[model samples]
Each structure stands twice: as C-alpha cells, then as structure tokens.
Target: MVKQVRAARTRQALVRAAAEVFAADGYAMASLPSISRRAGVSAGALHFHFASKDFLAREVEDAAADLVQKMAGEARSSSGTVLESLVGTTCRLLVAMAADPVVRAGFRLGSDPSRKNGPGVLAWWRTWVHERVAEAREAGELADDVSPEGAAAAIAAATVGFEVLGGADRDWLCEERAAQFWAFVLPRLAAFPQQAMATVTGAGGVR
Candidate 1:
C-alpha cells in the first residue's frame, strides 16, 4: 500500500512539474529532462511515468479537461439563468487558466501547432460554448439582434484572447476586466437590462 501511494505521489509530482514547465515555456521549448529536474525526479523515473513529451502533454491536457468540466458543471448546475451561468462559467475558466499551472499548460499545449495530434482543449471549449449559446438562444435569453453562432464565436474569441494576453500581464485575468467584458457584451447579447448588467464573477472568479 505504501509503495502504491508513493508511486502515485511521484506521478502527481511529475505531472505538476510538466505543467509548470509547459506553462512557462510552451510545447516546442519544453523538455522532459527539465520537467524531471523541476519535479526533483530522475530522468529514469520520468521515463517510467511517461514515455515521451507528447505523452506527458496529453496527460496534462487530460487533467485540464477534468478541471474545466468540473467548473463548467458547477456553473451549469448553479441556480442561475443561462446567461448568468455562462458568465460564471467563463469566470471560473479564466481564473483556472491564470491561477493553475496545470490548466494553463494544458491550454497552451492544446493550441500549440508544433505538437502533432494535440489534445485540442480549445476545440472542446468551443464546442461547449457553442452548445450553451445555442441553449440560451432557444430559451429566448438572447437579444433579437444576436445570433447564437455569432455570440458563441465572439465570446470564445474573447476568452481565448484573454488567456493569451494574460500570459504576459496577469492583470488581464482580473475580475474587473471580466466584469467589463461581460457588461459590454451583455447589452448586445441579452434582451433584459437585468441580464445585460448582471453582477458577474469575472476573470479569476469572485474574491
């Protein structure tokens, strides 16, 4: 039992190290040797845990997917309107990306064109946003001038933009920025003033 526990811990450490390295340097620049050094593990141990960099990256992506799904599920289950739910969901996502190395690395790897057969977390997120926007539209939550497709694309783009910009200035992930974004789009996206100007938890989530 102790051996199993130790093994699990080692694996976790390696994953966290990989996340840190990947988040800081991105895919093409990241190396397993560096990841092992950061994890305080030998290269042999890293090889035992992961066969290759691509393999390690995929694991990071999988972990990130789990993290995002949990947050999105929480937002979806919130006793709030669809628009509010979307706002909350985005808040959680931005916060995760900014605060969690694993998540940030996962996304970076997903979007890295150099990595063949990448996990495509960005694509997954786009699909998720697309579905929710469609649901909001069907529920008549959207403004008459808004189309579900357009709304989804615009929102996804903005979120991606934030993640990219946040890489340099973490201020990009501030809740104030998130609030401003939501407030700006709400008027054009939702019909009711209440929904448009709703008090939303912004990037990095509520304090």
Candidate 2:
C-alpha cells in the first residue's frame, strides 16, 4: 500500500513539474531531465512513470481537461441565467489559469502549433462556450443583435487571448481584467445587461 501511494505521489509530482516546464519553455524546448530535476525525481523514475515527453504532455493536457470540464459543469448548474453562467465560468477559467500551472500548461499545449497532437483542451473549451452561447440565444438571454456563433467565437477568442497574455504577465488573468472584459461585452451581449451584471457581481464575477 505504501509503495502504491508513493508511486502515485511520484507520478503526480512528475506531471506537475512537466506542466511547469512546458508552461514556461514550450513543448519543443522542454526536456525529460529538466522535468525530472524539477520534480526532484531521477530520470529512471520519470521514465518509469512516463515513457516519453509526449506521453507526459498528454497526461498534463488530460488532467487540465478534467478541471475545465468540472468548471463548466459547475457553471452550468449555477442558479444564474445562461449569460450569467457563461460570465461566471469565464471568470473562473481565467482565475484557474492564473493560479494553476496544470491549467496554464494545458491551454498552452493545446494551442502550441509545434505540437503535432489534436486540438486538445482549447477545442473542448470552445465547444462548451459555443453550446452555452447557443443556449443563451435560444432562451432570449442574449441581445437580438448578437448571433450565437459570433458571440461564441468572440468569447472563446477573448478568453484564449487572456490565457496567452497571462502566460507572460499574470496580471492579464486578474479578476479586474475579466470584469473589464464583461463590462465591455455585456452591453452588447446580454439582453438585459444590468440584471446580468448584478448577478455577476454578486456571484464573484467582478471584485
């Protein structure tokens, strides 16, 4: 039992260390030795846990995807309207990316063109955003001038942009920046901006 626990802990540490290295250095530049050193594990142990860098990268992306799904599920179950739920989720996502290296690396890896993998976490996020935006449109929660596709694209692009910027400066992922984004878009996106803003502010959307 102790050996199993130790093994699990070692795997977790390796994943985290790899995420940090990948988040900082990108996939092409991240190395197995560096990840092992950061994790405080020997190369042999890292190899035992993960066969290759690609496998480790996939593990990080998978872990990050799970977190994103959890966040989306929470937002979907929130008592607020669809628009408010979307806003809340976006705020949570930026905050997560800011604080969690796993999430940060997941997004970074998802968007890295150098990596020959599939769309990864970004595609999952964008799909979720589109679904929610479409739901909001169907429910008359969005402004008449707004199209679901356009709103989804804009929201996805903006959030992904924040993740990218936050990579260099965490201030980009601050709550204030998220609030500013909602403030700028709410007027045009929400059918009743004031009510949505009120719910948002009360629900930790801003401040």
Best by lDDT: 2
lDDT of each: 0.84, 0.89
Please provide, for model 2 over 1-207, each residue's C-alpha lDDT reduced to its tens digit, 9 standing for 90 to 100.
999999999999999999999999999999999999999999999999899999999999999999999988887787468887887788889999988999999999999888988869999999999998999988899998888899999999999999899877888986678878898888889998887777546433552
Residue 68's lDDT in candidate 2: 91
lDDT of 2 at 63: 96
In angstroms, the error of model 2 at 115 is 0.8
Summed over model 2, clashes come to: 0
Off by over 4 Å in 2: 202-204
Residue 4, model 2: lDDT of 100
User: Which run of 10 residues does model 2 get worst, by summed lDDT?
Assistant: 198-207
Stretches off by above 4 angstroms in model 1 are 201-207
TM-score of 2: 0.95
